[model samples]
Target: MLDANLKKQLDTYLQNIVSPIELSVSGDNSPKSKELLELATEISGLSGNISLREAAAGRTPSMSVAPAGQAPRVSFAGIPMGHEFTSLVLALLQAGGHPSKASPELQEQIRNLEGQFHFETYISLSCQNCPDVVQALNLMATLNPNISHVMIDGALFQEEVNQRQVMAVPAVYLNGEHFGQGRMSLEEIVGKLDTGAAARKAAALDDKAPYDVLIVGGGPAGAAAAIYAARKGIRTGLVAERFGGQVMDTVGIENFISVPYTEGPKLAASLEQHVKEYGVDIITDQRAAGIRRGELIEVPLASGAALKSKAVILATGARWRELKVPGEAEYRTKGVAYCPHCDGPFFKGKRVAVVGGGNSGIEAAIDLAGIVEHVTVLEFADSLRADEVLQRKANSMGNIDIIMSAQTTEVLGDGSKVVGMQYTDRVSGESKRLEVAGIFVQIGLVPNTEFLQGSEVELTRFGEVVIDNRGATSMAGVFAAGDATTVPYKQIIISMGAGATAALGAFDHLIRAGS
Candidate 1:
């Protein structure tokens, strides 16, 4: 199933296996089963330490990886190809007793888990976010014998996907019940299962000494700021709910300068690695609750812990703008999705609607036209705001229909899943309903400044933090940058530049204030 180059690389990775391992194959005479067996055989052939055996499991066309004679803890219910191929490789190494890159504390936390955990994650092959969840669970299963995880391909297992009403990728289930439905770090997953870990960690954070510069986000802007501050020979720290921010949901990023092409997750990983090279104290899985202005600026976390710093840089970034119509939140995962690249595959051969006319919406329509039966683009404006090149490409597609001056009013669902969408004709003042199985909202972004509401910091009417040319905010000793600030552009490169400027501005403030 793998090409020659892929086999060569797998061979190189398999050399890292220090202990004996086994591949337990469960399959039938079906084509998928045969394909799986072929892939398993190819993997087993790479190293002498690896062996294979047929086994009976509840799910067919599955393979389990573990040490010889041990009950396999890491299993794949479907072919782990595409984005999950890396997951397959990692599972092999971890199951073969190779040490993981996870922190020693986190590994111990997994080992101390008390109960048996059977995690099943539904994923699509094209999803960039699914691998993180899958790989994390797989590592947990490897670290703790009581934990077992199975990665299930949603597209290949349509029956289960429909039964679970899984309209989104990276949907996780624990012990046959819903656990989560998005990108989650290993720390976040373990904190959920361990229950008391959050409070303990929060208390530890509360006791930390004040930093010279504290960054309140982990996107590109926050990363750049952390690097700059750390390089300035000062105490730098960064806190974030997630490191990647909105970039994690992004798919193709061809416009980033210096690099010809890259994906969101890859760039986010590089940014994180670069920040780690500095002396910055990186804190994850923590959301900023509010900021308090004082002699030393304070940023409180949602977990009840507050961090203090001489200066603070707010780069909380932004999130996808939602359609605030009725039934939209009720059926968010049921049928309404915000990412076309992540959730588009779930609506194969079904009709879907794109609720915007910008570049993102038109691009989504063009991408979905190949998979879905039909795509209707709804534009509240009279003309599309997409680039002329994109408009031309979308117009050339037969399955795409552009609806001008159509305002989305409501999402229609049958309690279980989406059945259609309701919109209003702005010009004719007529209400219209279109039968679509899914609604992909491609509207612009809203700054993630809700946490800053009621704070002393001045903000624009749109909730963006008002900033000067030096990136300093109205609040003394506090600066802002990136999407959270009133920046004219929201591109990645622009965010990075703003981050550097904010860091420098904070440093200047610290020097002048006699910090």
Candidate 2:
């Protein structure tokens, strides 16, 4: 566990000096330098940015990706608490924005392997801007054999730019293809790698023959598909950008039927374990670029690996559609939180808010009532959309209060932490502020099917993978299930059942194809 004083001191450091551009600011350390940023730089990778280290040591610190670029310049490991996390990588990404020649390894691989090495580092010359971006990219290129970069001047890159037909400084062109123009955010770049990786994989797989079963998502659905099919005597393989799917973010998953109170991480871990136990080959951190036609399915991986399978099951689950309010993304751990189960324990006896009015929201508020000192539920609807049971439970909680027709207007906080929130009453257009330690978003979930870029798998109007009674999809030898599928319920029990059903269907398809 991070010492309380240390965490607080780190919080102070984050608010005053941390910015994605800090790129952890200067690998060179000089004690004579009297700047918070320099101090930040010195201590940024203190733990070697190793989340695994803390976990192995039995201390809980939730860390996601560093602020920028492909690899770890500062290795923003551990739960990215504040601006320090951002500073760690921004410097590296800033370095990416140059004609700065790289080592032979970078020059040979990333410069042309996938196509072109195009990148735009968004920054001003300030220490807060360009330095981190450049350094982060340098670090990232070390891991990926095929990635190189060039920088664009912040002042000149902004001049009368022709984003189209290519006359731009801060933009990258990949084999004459424009990657992006204007200021590139971290999320934007992450999305870019996703497609870029997928594109390369799809192209490579275009030549392969299909297999018995090809699972599109590497989440609960795909993992289950691989396990069940392998168990039932069928050849199967799973592809996804990241293994364990969003379930990895889930600290614990108690609602997942059969298992009444399991950590989400534990559940996902066990699922991955079970799949491997059945001899199901699980590809971690790979995406399905595309699925080509054949007697079976020819699925491509973002890593340029091609896989073939007879039937494909899209177990791609759902992701939380963010509020997109300002501080929501910026100050995530610094007071802005998502999962009640994950971050709730940290705020014991503190005030918090839950967004939305449906059963999910009401249930969350009701659950939070017991833990936090105060619980405020902001609902966009006139009345709660929760079922009677949840509504009754929420109404019964003294600490929980509901505000109808309320919508989040702005997430206001110190640059490094969230201290309050602003909302507008739908009826009167009146705005108000609420002070809370965290806000839970129970608004909705989005199915993960972006990989179906060119496939025939049908999706519902709501973006779910369409499936028949047995969890079969519109395409022959393909199956669908879990939240991503057209299954009405997104409950865990239903997802498991659907996963089983699809596995069975894939097994049947395999048997018939073999016979």
Candidate 3:
């Protein structure tokens, strides 16, 4: 269907448009700027050719041509950096080729409510967790381009945000209304999206993750936070690196007030289940890496996607501290690991050592005794530090051996694989070496807060973010909760309370800013 001249021009455009050389010139020119310039000239020539072709066909000169076989898909609104790049390019290509019909029945419905939305998100450039918020929004927009998304940097958009009454990065505005502040689930958007009453005029939009609030984390604190936040009538979203936080590595949670005998993971699961009843957005395996702070928050993911949000709650729990022993890092996946539940099954019939004499070490050793051929528990303390019950259980396990007053001096490996370990006796000053197939180090955990550098916040001596009774950090428009902060007596129940407090503080910040 293409005329000879038009086809030649189209092919030429495609060929030159994708070159790195064309992306930039060596001097002061920028890649994107030059790329756009080159594209404009090509488009102009292409447009002129199309016009002439239409005129010859007896159609009006202003009429658009069908390129090869398709209609052009045009961008109706904003497309900045991050995941929007692909969407924008695709839209332009489709616009040049063919228009696509709405893929879902909800298309028309979204169009009706399109005029009612005004969304803005704010985020910090340095924050790792901010990227998830970016992807969620981009996905929503791609699902229906009628939904407009505006991104603003939280640091730079401070003045505009204060005018809008925003107290944090990652804020959303719906129909000129403040939707909420913090990390949101698709469900939250769905709830705010008007698909009812007006459905008689437009088709019904299919149900998706329409959330009121989304709490990210599955630790005791995350669960507790969700219980409180969701009870307040908001759809919550929860994304955890794992189901539980540091406590999940714990054998038991003794000081959790009333829960006399509860394990970490089970408790986490219970909380997760409870939050699900309230329709919280629970996403596991989704990690936030980079944040774009502004009126709208954009979070880039480890998977190269992004999520956007109005406000965000970080319940990303911390990881246990490693001894950083020699060979530890080198042999990580080959024969050393942290979580026994995840890697224990692979070590079946293999000899392994669990480092540490604390409750965690003993607990891990006992668990591994059932799976691995042999379990060696190493302790640097004079005697076992774990509770009497755990010690008793470790003693009863025939294949489990406890070596007290010993520390791992070196982790030995064969470059490509872990082979053994070197140990020193604290009392006798004697050294011993043991060959093992696997090593599971369980000392304790470090707060997963390394990503908050350069942000307006205070960190404890231990590097945890310091916060007050209300989960208010030293900075304005910013607050932190969960294991990453400096709330002592790190318990699941306590963290949950802390998360709830933080969310409330965020709510207060939003109310004050909005009012």
Candidate 4:
């Protein structure tokens, strides 16, 4: 249910629509179904041009928006709540004859498609990236008769999620094949569709010609390393599953040293552009499966290709550590999330919990306080480890409540979504429960180093690659930087500096070895 102010705003938005829109709501007697039906009824009542009808229940709760003349092919298999609320509104607007925001080229491509294309995008209500992919597929489906799209909420369909091995949100299936995951651009989706390729080919690797310096990971650190290596005018190569790494998931980044303000995607674009300006052989959409340390390091990719490099810079970054508690995994994306920026909007006006007292957790609380109704921070330690400045800011927020020495025991959820969290106060040895819609786990980070399990490269107890002052690892001709390594801090600026140092170290090593 929307508040008075939001309902008024929606009423104003719907007043401009001229075309008639039909909303078909179909579901069983489930709670999710009742919630969706109530919301749909309320939304349809706001506009005279819109109408709501009941459809036969199928496998799951579903809703569809049909334009005046077009058949109903665009459907959502779950309640489009949270950040996806906008998606539902936009679907209604589009069904009411509003034009799509897709580029002319993309519109033409969708219009001229010959073969039938069906897209099933599995998404969480909290994912910030899902909206773009879902909207793109919906637009294509609405524009073309042969194109059909379904947005499936992964949390509500755990069996399907497990069967598909979907470990992440925004997992897309084009014609029943896993197309890709994460935030994808409309143009990228169009390109993939037009090319009819589920996976993009990496840059050709020649075993005979080994690269002088090969950089792994494509975050800020790896990008900087590639730029530095390319400046030497040597054969440099960079491989990454994605270009932006953690930076892509971030939203507001005000502390990038000199930059006054910038978002994550903008910074990621700039990094990619800067890397492209040089002669760096950048290979994307490929993950390094393993590394063979020898005279020439051999890095095998998941795609069955191998790359040989005289020197390697491991800039692989870190990911948010999971709570690993009961209901945490089950309610992931349903209410349990990692990135506040990515999923915070979905919990607007709802009470949420932040599981951590460090800088990230405090920051998350501070950020969510402005959007959500309330924020409760649970710290495992007796005191928060975040800087005084962050703690001060968090304390200033009236909506934030910090609980120290709190051990999260479980993430309680309904069969379909999260409803509350259970924790224990370490000092009192008493358990407690907090009724909240979402939980953001920001305990810490885990380095992306599982692929290097048997490699000669030394790693710390925490699995971070051990590096010297110059970013050189224990093994010769091997270097590492960024959060993946034993770096003091995991900031973007520091990672860039580390990457540069590693590149210089690699160049110096090559020079000495050649002499």
- Which residue runs does candidate 4 get wrong by more than 4 Å? 1-115, 118-181, 184-209
TM-score each candidate. Answer: 0.98, 0.56, 0.52, 0.70
Candidate 3's TM-score reads: 0.52
lDDT of each: 0.94, 0.59, 0.58, 0.84
TM-score of model 2 relative to the true fold?
Answer: 0.56
User: Which portions of model 3 show Cα errors greater than 4 Å?
Assistant: 1-218, 233-270, 277-285, 290-293, 296-311, 345-350, 371-374, 396-399, 427-430
* C-alpha-based local distance difference test score of model 2: 0.59
In model 2, state the lDDT of residue 204. Answer: 46
- 392-508: candidate 1 lDDT, tens digit per residue: 999999999999999999999999899999999999999999999999999999999999889889999999999999999988999999999999989999999999999999999
Report the poorest 10 consecutive residues by lDDT, candidate 2.
Answer: 53-62
Q: What lDDT is obtained when candidate 3 is compared to the true structure?
A: 0.58
Residue-wise C-alpha lDDT for candidate 3, range 172-234, written one tens digit per residue: 666577776544544345535664533331122122333333444567767776777677765
Clash count for each candidate, listed in order shown: 0, 44, 72, 0
**What is the C-alpha lDDT profile of model 4 across 201-272, one tens digit per residue?**
333443336899999999999999999999989899998877888888776788899898986767887998
lDDT of 2 by residue, 1-515 (tens): 34567656554544433223223222113232224233344445442331211112111111222333333322322222222334433333333342323345334434344533434343222112223344435444433445544333322222312133121123344444666543233323443655565454346455545546667776776777787888776666676665667665554466766677874545666887788787765554466666677644676666667787767787879888778886787766456655564445445588888988887778778767877899999998898888998888888878988899998987877665567799999999999999986787889888877777557878777778788888878888878889888788777667777888998987776677773
Candidate that would win on TM-score? 1
As for lDDT, the candidate ahead, 1 or 3, is 1
